[model samples]
Target: MPHVPERRPESLGQAAYRQLQEAIETGALKPGDRVSVNALADQLAISRTPVREAIAWLETDGLIVHQPYLGRVIAELDHQMVNELYALRFVLEPAAVGMAAKNATDAEIDVLREMIAFERSVLDDPIERERHNRRFHNALYRTAHNRYVISTLSALQTPMILLGPATASDPKRLLDAYAEHTELVERIAAHDAEGARAVMMRHLTGGQRARVSYLLNQQRS
Candidate 1:
C-alpha cells in the first residue's frame, strides 16, 4: 500500500487550511460542493484532525456552512451576494483610485505601471492575469494611503477569488480591461483624481455586469 508522502514538517492545521482555500479560490472545490473530511485528508495526505480544524475555521469565515444533515458545503454564490459585493466595491474602490491619483509616490506609481505590464504579458493565462490584476489593485489600495481601506479590502480577497475565472477568461475582455487599466493609470499618473475615480467606477460597473452574465450563463448550463 502507498504511504503518505512526507515532504517536511509544517503546521497541519495551517497547511490543510491553505490547501482547501486554494481549491475554493480556483473553483476546484466550487460553490455548493460537499466537503468530505476523510476524502480531503486522504487527498492532502494528512489526518482528519487537521482537516476538521480547518473546516471549523472556514465555517467561521462564512466560506463554508453546516447544514442539518449534509455537513459542510462551500457557500453558494448567488445574485444577491454579487450585488452586495459590487455595491461595496463601488463605494470603496472609486475612493481608493481617487486617493491613489492624488497621493501616490513616484515609486508607487511605477509599481502600478509594472503590474499592468505584467498583466498584459499574461493575457493567455487567465489565472496569472487575475493574480497580477489583484496585485495591481492591492498596490493601488496601498497608494491610497488608508490603512483602514487596505485592511478592509484585504479581507475581501477570498470572496473576490471565489467569483471564478469568467471575467479574465476571454481574450477580448482582457484587451478591453487592458485599455481601461491604461486609461485609469494615465489619469492616476497625471494626478487627475476625478478622472481616475470616473474610470474606476466604470471599471467596477462593467465588472459587475460581466459577473452577473457569467453567473446567469452558468445557471443555464
Candidate 2:
C-alpha cells in the first residue's frame, strides 16, 4: 500500500477517505487486493468507525464492490468504466474549454501558459507529470468562472482516480497529449471559442477510441 499522507482534515473520517482514495488511485490497492476494515484502520492510525465510513463512501463511488463471501474487492478495470469516463469527459471538458475561450482573463491564460512552461522540470517524475496534467485541466475548467461546472467536476473522480494508472502509459502518447493541451490553450488564448471546442472534441475523441480499442482487444487476448 502507498503511504498516503493525511490531509488537512477536519474529521478522521475525511482523512481516512482521502488516504484510501489516494491508495486506490496509485494502484497500491489493486483489483484483487483485500480491503479489511480492521487492517485499514490500523494502517491509517484511525478508528474503525472512520474507516468504515470511508469504505462506504468509496463503495458509492463504484470503486469498491462487496463480493459475496469474498468481502470487499476493488472494482475490476473494464471497457464500460473507461467508456463511461470518456462519455462524461466529452460532455463537460469541451464545454468548459469553450466557455474558457470566451471568458478567460489575461491572468488566467497566463496561469495555463506557466503550467505548460513548468512541465520540463517534472518530466522525470511520473507522479508529478500526472499531477501537472490535472492542475492544467483544472485551471482550464476554472477559467470558465462557472461555480456549477467547477463544483461538479471537482467532485468527480478523475480518469486516473476512476480507473487504475493511465491507459496512455506510452511516452509518445504522453508527448502527444501535452501537444494537444498546448493547442487547445492557444485556441483559448485567441478567444476562439469554436476553435477551442473543436480542438477539445478532437482530443477527447482520439483518446476515447484508442483506450476503448485497447481494452476490447485486451479482452480478446
Candidate 3:
C-alpha cells in the first residue's frame, strides 16, 4: 500500500519505519490487514533487514500483533484498549489544554484557529478530515510548552490511528466536533485555563462514548 522510491542511502531503517508507519496511520493499511515483511521490503525498494526492523518496532508499539491464524496483522481497537486510551487522555489532555491557555502566544492561538478553518473546508473528505484532526490536536498540545505531556501524547498516535477520529463516522458528529474545537480555541485565546480544561474534558468524553458505541455496532454487524 505504501509506494516509496529507491533508497536514498540515508538511514534506511528509519525511512522504512516512517513509510510503514505512515501507511498504517493513513488507512492505506487498515486494521486486521495481514503484513508481509517481504512485500513491504520489496514495495519500498529496500532490503529485508530494515523492513524487519520496522516490523519489530511496530509490534512493540502495539500497531501490529501476532494472532493464532492471522499472523502479524494490523491491530484493532478492542474495548479495553479504547478505555485505556481515553483514560490516559482524560488525565493528560485536559491539563495540556489548560497549560496551553496559560502559555500559548497569540500567534500560536491563531495557528489553531487556522487549523479549525481548514478542518471545516475538508469536512467532506474523510481522509483530509482525519489528517487535519491529528494536526489540530498536535498543534494544540505543542502550545502547552510541556515536553513530558507532548511526548506522552505523541506516543499514543499509532494506537489512536486504529480508533480513527470523531469526524470519520457521521456528518452530525463532525459538525458537533467542529463546534467543540471552535469553542476550545476561543477559551484558549481568552486565557481561560479552567474553561479550556473543562471544554477538553467534554470533547474527550464525547469521543470516548462515540467510539464505544461504534465498536458495539461493529460487533453486532
Candidate 4:
C-alpha cells in the first residue's frame, strides 16, 4: 500500500477568532452579548482552547470584555469612544488621502473610479451599498501604499460596523457621500494631494456626524 500523507491539524484558534470577529461586526454578536466558550466551541466544531484564545484576542482588540464573574461580553460603544474613533479617523484618513494622491498609479485610480460606479449602481440596496462603501475606502487606503496606515484603518473598520445600519440609509446623505468620494477620486487622479486631503477630511467629518446622529436617535427611541 502506498503511504498516505498525514492530515494537517486545523488552527481552531485562528478560525474561532475570525468567526467571532465577523459575528461582532455583522451585529449577530451585538454589544453586551455574552460570550460562551463551550457554546462557541460547539458552534464552531472546535476545541475550548481555541475559543478561549479567540476571546483573549477580541478582548485585546477592545472588541469584548471578560469579567471575573460576569464572563465575556461584547464591548459596548459609549459616546466618548465614538468621539475618540472619529477623532482618530479625522487625523489619519486625511493623511492617507494625501499620500494616496501623491503615490497612486493610474491603474489604481481607474480601480477607484470603477468602485465609485459600482457604489452608484447599488444605491438602492443598503447591504450592497455598504459593501461598496467599504470597497471604496479600502481602495483609497491601498492607494496610500503605507502598510501601517492600511492595517490601522482596516482594524478601525470593525468598530465602525458597530454603528449599525448602512450610511446609505439616508438618500440625501448618501448622495453627499458619493459626491465627496467622486471629488476625492478626481483630485487623486489630478495628483492634487492637498485638495484630496481636504476633501477627504471634510467627507469623514460629515460621515462621523451622520453616524453619531443616527446612533443618538436609536438610543432615544
TM-score on alpha carbons, each prediction: 0.89, 0.84, 0.87, 0.84
lDDT of each: 0.84, 0.79, 0.86, 0.84
lDDT of 3 by residue, 132-193 (tens): 88888988889999999888887875587775543277777778788999999999999999
Q: Write the per-residue lDDT of candidate 1 for residues 1-221, one digit (tens) a residue.
A: 89989897778998999888878867798888898999999999999999999999888777888777888899877877888988888999999989999899999889888888887788888767777778777888999999988988766655777766655766666787888898898899999999999999988887787778778888899
Q: Can you write out model 2's per-residue Cα lDDT over 114-221, one digit (the tens) per residue?
A: 888787566656566766767777888899999888876655545345445555566766677778888998999999999999999988887777677767776798
Q: Which stretches of candidate 2 lie over 4 Å from their true place?
A: 1-9, 166-168, 213-221
Model 1 TM-score (2 dp): 0.89
Off by over 4 Å in 3: 1-10, 68-70, 164-167
Clashes of 3: 0
Candidate 2 clashing pairs? none
Winner by TM-score: 1
The TM-score of predicted model 2 comes to: 0.84
What does candidate 4's lDDT look like per residue over 1-221, in tens digits?
Answer: 99999988757888899888878766678877889988989988888998999999988888888766878888877666888988888888999999999999999999999988888898887666776787789889999999999999978876766655544578888899999999999999999999999998889888878887777776898
Candidate 2: residue 211 lDDT (0-100): 71
Candidate 4 segments exceeding 4 Å error: 1-10, 67-69, 166-168
Candidate 1 residue runs with Cα over 4 Å from true position = 1-10
